[model samples]
Target: MAPGGNRGWLLRLVIAFSFAQGAVSMARPAVSYRALALGADERAIGVIAGVYALLPLFAAVPLGRRTDHGRCAPLLPVGVVLISGGCAMSGIANSLWGMAVWSGVMGLGHLCFVIGAQSLVARQSAPHEQDRNFGHFTIGASLGQLVGPIAAGALIGGRDMAGTSAFALLVAGAGGAVALTSLWHIESRTTSKSREEQGERVPVRRILRARGVPAGIFISLAVLSATDILTAYLPVVGEHRGIAPSVIGLLLSLRAAASIACRLVLTPLLRLLGRTLLLTVTCLLAALLCAGIAL
Candidate 1:
């Protein structure tokens, strides 16, 4: 089927993605809170947070290569399983070390899901439709990010810090599993990877030097790093200041809501300012705002 023919699969994909991402999002802060309850010092908490990024670092290329050669649909389930297992296991873990390990597994699962999702988007979409499809996909992610923190905030926090946070993690696991329901038959059978894609690997350096590639990568990395830092440390900051978990969650959700608003307005904004200036202005504003938050 042509990419423009039916968009129902896209909606389903977004819903499933939201659930998976929400599970991860909720687990992030809950992990931090639970770590604190497990007698973690600042350094230990830092290590655990860093683990999420580091664990997925080396696995990207391999997973991408696999998707290039095989099917993308299978990776979605693998991701859901890993995410669910990580969240549930982390809840039961008694030590920072165990939490770190599970956190890595969780990160890997997320990487798998993203790789699969992106691959599916490329395979199933015509070039003209690619931009809109990607935008829609990002909205799904934003929805999860926006809701997850609020849910975490509501479920965590109380006299029994460890117990409450663990409960939240368990809940996240169940939420992740819910995504499985929407995963059935999302990928088009005819959209399998082309023989050309299955052949030789593109030279990474050549691709990186292509027009707009480096800048796009930089922007994506910058934005992602900022959000990851927020998810990892915001709750810790709240804990230190004696802030309520629900309040912290609200703050995080607002950030996510702003992200969604930006995505919605992006097309018109791009037409007005053009891509370069739009990116420049937005990045500057983000830098200033994030710095203010840090202070």
Candidate 2:
């Protein structure tokens, strides 16, 4: 929608997303390491990590509904502020509860950023263009996931675990703020929103009843939860085994790199094996690898 249908906006959006997502990716492991240094048991660690997800579950629907009616740019800055504040505060928080509270705030900020970003993509693209644009947009997330853990590892895993981890978190806060640099003029004021949709919202029951919907949701949940579990707990596992944080970060980067590679080849793989077969094979492989990691 630029003067010549330029996609400069998409590139800037991707850059902003990379920084935002990088901060979160870095913060998650730093939080775990930081919690461990605070004398938190694995139980406490789980509680703190889980809180990062809990608030977002309750907040996303309302936030989405709100974004549906308003400009998406506002949420981006708000989200950045929350993410930055939460990361910085968590670094300084001495108490377990304080860390948990800040973690939840970061999670909510993440949800806000993602929903707003995705909605902007949807609203800006035509139906025929949505697939390509969305694909390009998700590449930002992959880039962040690939880089963030390495940076965190470089900063953490010192003899002063508490201090080093806190420093990493502070750095992540600064990284998140960098996203604000690209957010200017992100939403076009000329874009109108007063028009109504063509139809009423579909009933939840009907959506649930649709063939493949529940199954697809379950598959996505399984995949995403596995990644989250690794991000939050791998450092703990590394600690138990006396593994270096840098090594753990390398492992995570490897995981992310594989994910990006798979996405790059997804279309060709889909064509070669078809969806059901690809799903089964990928799930089986993932289960085996996960079991190996456990051992």
Candidate 3:
């Protein structure tokens, strides 16, 4: 850790990310509900949800490419703007098409922010410290995931479907704004030249073929997909089971908190089992948990 590197940035990043992520999480369900209220069928809701992911899919790699060569801090503010605007606009939009557009914007914003933020982390941390730092960084996301829906559930309701939905979106926008606080001092001029040279266009295929790259990518993809499906579909399960939204939120938060706890103690765990064994064991446990959820 460098000077002022006593995990202070990590903490600030997590806190900022929590608020930003919380807003998005809160807004997502609200969007789904609001869409339903506006007469969107399950298929329509699915389409809208898919749109959020779809729009971002094309942008992720390019954004990553850019961040590799440029300042990560710029993307933070830009992402905040997009997220806030998207959430707020989605609320106000009277038509499904309008909602879809804004949702795409929100997704794009998220992609930008994530690319930038991840790049920042990679740039900032020492090699030996990367794993712990990255683990700590994601805790912010987990925290946001835990809090966002609860906030949404609290703010949205009362049969005034449109009204409540609008409120939720507006609130999400405000939450996006909260991420701005972390934007301060995010970029460092010192590392600019080194990063630019390193980020220079390299063959994507070459990078992918590098040692550990394939495995790492696969693991990340699998884990993220599992988590995504879990988050998206869990509420539907709850709805069918007649669980309250607040209860569902709490349950999800419990899971997230547990994950945070895991990360907090990741160093000890890693030391105990080492990386390969640790990943295998935890991922296997996660598989079992997913199965349990499905059951």
Candidate 4:
């Protein structure tokens, strides 16, 4: 079959991705609450949360490189397993260190799934259809992000914070497992067969030196750092302010919904301002938002 010839695979991929991302979304806040119930302070929470991204940061490039040379299908299931296990294990962990380790595992799993899924999309879509396919792909993530927190909030709360949070994590693991049902034949067999790959790998230095690469990386890093800090710190902030877990969850859901809204409007924004200006303006606004949040 020609790339993008059949739409069924795309639908399945989106469904699976939704479940996978939903699991991570639900687990993130649950992890924070569980850590707090186990006596974690703000600093401790920060460290543990930071560890979630640390493993992925170092592992993503290598994983991407491997995907470039091999089939992308295998990583998807491996990622799902790791994410589910990490969530369930983190629920049972009694100490901060153990939670941190499991959180890192979760992050690594997410990285794996993303790299594989993205590579799959790139390989399966025609050049002209790439933009639309990617847009559809991201909507799956948005759907997951939008729903996960609400579900988490609905489940986690009450005097037994630890118990409730642990329950939520277990549920998240189950939710991740749901993705496996959608994974049947998600990858195209044509691409999975080993063939002689064209060209040598691009040198890291040369790639980094390419025009706009640094700027794009820095922008992504900044936005990601802000988002991560917000997710990891919000529950602590809520505890300090006496806000309820449900309310925090609602706020997080609202934030995600706003992100979805932004994506919906992105085409118009790009048409009006073009990519460079739009990115610049958004980055500036993001910096201001982060500063305000800090205050």
- Listed per model in order, the count of residue pairs whose N, CA or C atoms clash below 3 Å is 0, 0, 0, 0
Evaluate residue 264 in candidate 4 and report its C-alpha lDDT on the 0 to 100 scale. 85
1 against 4, candidate with superior TM-score: 4
Instruction: Find the 10 residues in a row with the least total lDDT in model 4.
Output: 189-198
> Per-residue alpha-carbon lDDT of model 3 for 1-295, expressed as tens digits?
3522556676777777777788788777778767767877666766777778777889877777777775566887788788888899999998888888888898888887788778777777778888778887887788788788788777766668668868988999998898888766655432443563684588789989999999998999889778766665665666568666567667767777887788778889989999999999989999999999889
Is candidate 2 or 3 superior in lDDT?
2
Off by over 4 Å in 3: 1-12, 126-132, 188-191, 194-200
State model 3's lDDT: 0.77
lDDT of each: 0.87, 0.87, 0.77, 0.88
Sort the candidates on lDDT, descending order: 4, 1, 2, 3
Candidate 2: clashing pairs of residues: none
TM-scores, in order shown? 0.93, 0.94, 0.85, 0.96
Any runs in candidate 1 off by more than 4 Å, and if so which?
188-190, 197-200
Pairs of residues clashing in candidate 4: none
**Candidate topping TM-score:** 4
Model 4: lDDT of residue 238: 83
Encode model 2's per-residue lDDT on 4-81: one tens digit a residue.
156777788899889999999889999999999999998998899889989998987778767667556678888988
lDDT-wise, the better of 1 and 4 is 4
Number of the top lDDT candidate? 4
